[model samples]
Target: MNKISESGVIGVDVHTIKSWIDQDDVVLVDVRETSEYDKEHIPGAMLLPMSKFDAEIFPKVLGKKVVLHCAVGKRSESAGKMLIDEGYLETVHMIGGIEAWKASGFATEVQITPPPSPSELKNQEPQFLCPTPGEVLRDEYMTPLSISNAELAGCIGVTEKDIEQLTQGESKVDVVLSLRLARYFSTAADFWVHLQIERDLEEARHEIGHTIREEISPRATASN
Candidate 1:
């Protein structure tokens, strides 16, 4: 409970939050629903939904700054007040919560549990699945190269969202990104492009099998 002038709850912008994350000086609390948090959230935020917020954790976070955030900012503001009223000296909440963070071009991570081990994977039945290009970027490049999304984006002359989206599977890899990835990894551009094609085809096949069938007409060709 670091003290910061008994002034209700201080509001911080996304920039300040980024700095805090880089400097390792802040404890980010996602006071949103677990489901919401699971979809996407700040890279290092801890989920403590407003529904079951634990005042007892305040003591543990004492000495370090604590910041709370919800989908927008209202819930976090309320949660901040609760902390303040409960004697947690200083508290801050993101001015616009997760939405603002994303709008500001910051990186977000989907909260998926790690995949099973090779042994476990072998035990499971085989399925027609394609890995996201982002998964490849993360495991094959980012982790091996020890590079952050910001660093890669800066070097490759693209917005962080471009890299983040590709890695998170939210966006497909276009010609431009494929070239960039290939150039950065010293691989052929086709390698990256093919990854996207494979995933799209697999997903399309899966959806077709699960959904109702629709009739299709053959395309007419030009006559010589």
Candidate 2:
């Protein structure tokens, strides 16, 4: 049995694999079936199922750092070892595969729909006014109420850059600031909710604002 070194075989979790995909430095090859690949996969992963590995597909990926993944980790590990033996110097495997990626709070392309249109946001209110006491509002209404760093700055009257660190998830949530947000959004919700749902809120608010701007901006003259 040929033992691969710990460092030699990079055991990446799915989140790191996603980062690698974004960078375009590595190639993700799923050694699963065509049916499996079509169902859902990492955005840029090439499908070279292990069943067809002996064919022309496997030879082309040689001399590159090949990150192998399957539904679970079992098949990928086996494929990684084979690639290493076949003279591919760098072979990494995603330890927990796609399921691990989702569990780590990383977004997946599967089952996601396009965001709502501008008209949708403009008609919607940021606050969820209660019809009955303690009733939970729809996810659509509650989701937009969360403030982003940009909106948070707007709420408290601060510069965009002043809250840039906060947007990046680096800054600590200030309790005083949280209280201020609750007041600004006209609710007593947690500050971290703002940080968590900031991006969604920003897009929704911007779209609504854009719709208003378009409606108000004067139409251009036909003749100069």
Candidate 3:
């Protein structure tokens, strides 16, 4: 309905977003948490929880505008800016979010699911970006199953000290460990590897993000 800035992201009414959705000209991303999303959400909006949002991981919205919306618009505005910062030429955020849409008599899809126990939620909830893979392993995977490092080591054919060191962040997740954990946890080995890589890259970014531009230059190609 109104332009908020010079950048591509702009505020639009629920009807405008609905029209874009109807025309299939926009990729709608709901930036609300999973709990809220599971209860009810815009019929076609893909859930990308703000708590775990990674701009780099925003879905492929090729040839279509990316529209973000939340419960009431604030999260969508922030998410829109995230797309802008990630070099999106233009982005749109629904001004009133699903709340406004519902107020306007728009239909929403609801997912039926059982609520998780509080302890389950505590164990499953991740620290945004999850500071370390070890923390993730200890808090999420291990504690939830009541598996001590010694037990996990025994089950996975690794030494107790190895598991201890890994959970302590004193060691890293290697191919062997990844495979072992994957087998024991019924997960992909790549999952552990990716977690380690994400942690390493996040630390690197924090350590040198600001200096990257000044320190590196694009290689020149030979003039034709």
Candidate 4:
């Protein structure tokens, strides 16, 4: 009874076609001008231009559904009708064609999108400027207490260069320095060490935060 169906040519939407590409065994046949295809086309599509379209020799993958499409629906419908006329079991063509596919925000083989400029890239790439421990030292303790680099170095039992680099954000505060700073400031050692950890995390985030988010996801969130 299904073989006696009303129409052999089935019209499919771009979203459905896209799902077929992603989830099913399907072959996309593009019937368009060479110039048009050279500009932009669906990835992995077989080009069989309508200018020289021959339905008799139309490719049919053994276990795959052949989906025909053109720039607009007209030529593809005509092409599909040709296949039906050629004693084909069934024919499928994308309704609204590549025009609908582009309208639906699907990526094509050729990209006409302009690249961002240097200034635009700079604006797009985020800068995370969390307070470095050097900034904390200079702003919170050193400036308020009027502790000179030499004075702090002598008191903390560190070289003047070490204190200078630490205050200038070029060096990191480790356990020894954190303990010394904590004892001198009468604060918990965790305070300085935590600041260093926070600074390290901020730096790491600035460098590869986006890549990490793209590559790794929580298992629950990934399933969703």
Q: Which residues of candidate 4, in runs, are more than 4 Å off?
A: 1-8, 111-224
Alpha carbon lDDT at 47, candidate 2 = 84
Give the root-mean-square deviation of each candidate in angstroms: 21.3, 18.5, 16.2, 27.1
Candidate number with the higher lDDT (1 or 4): 4
lDDT of 4 by residue, 102-172 (tens): 89999788847688899899789643323466766775567756899999999989988998999888999
Worst lDDT run of 10 residues, candidate 1, spans: 1-10
Better of 2 and 3 by TM-score: 3
Cα deviation of 132, candidate 2, in Å:
50
Task: Give the number of colliding residue pairs in candidate 1.
Answer: 2
Clashing residue pair totals per candidate (backbone < 3 A): 2, 0, 1, 0
Error of 2 at 13 (Å): 1.9
Provide the overall lDDT of each model, using Cα atoms, as 2-decimal numbers: 0.72, 0.55, 0.74, 0.74
Model 4 residue 10 lDDT score = 74
Which residue pairs come into collision in candidate 4? none
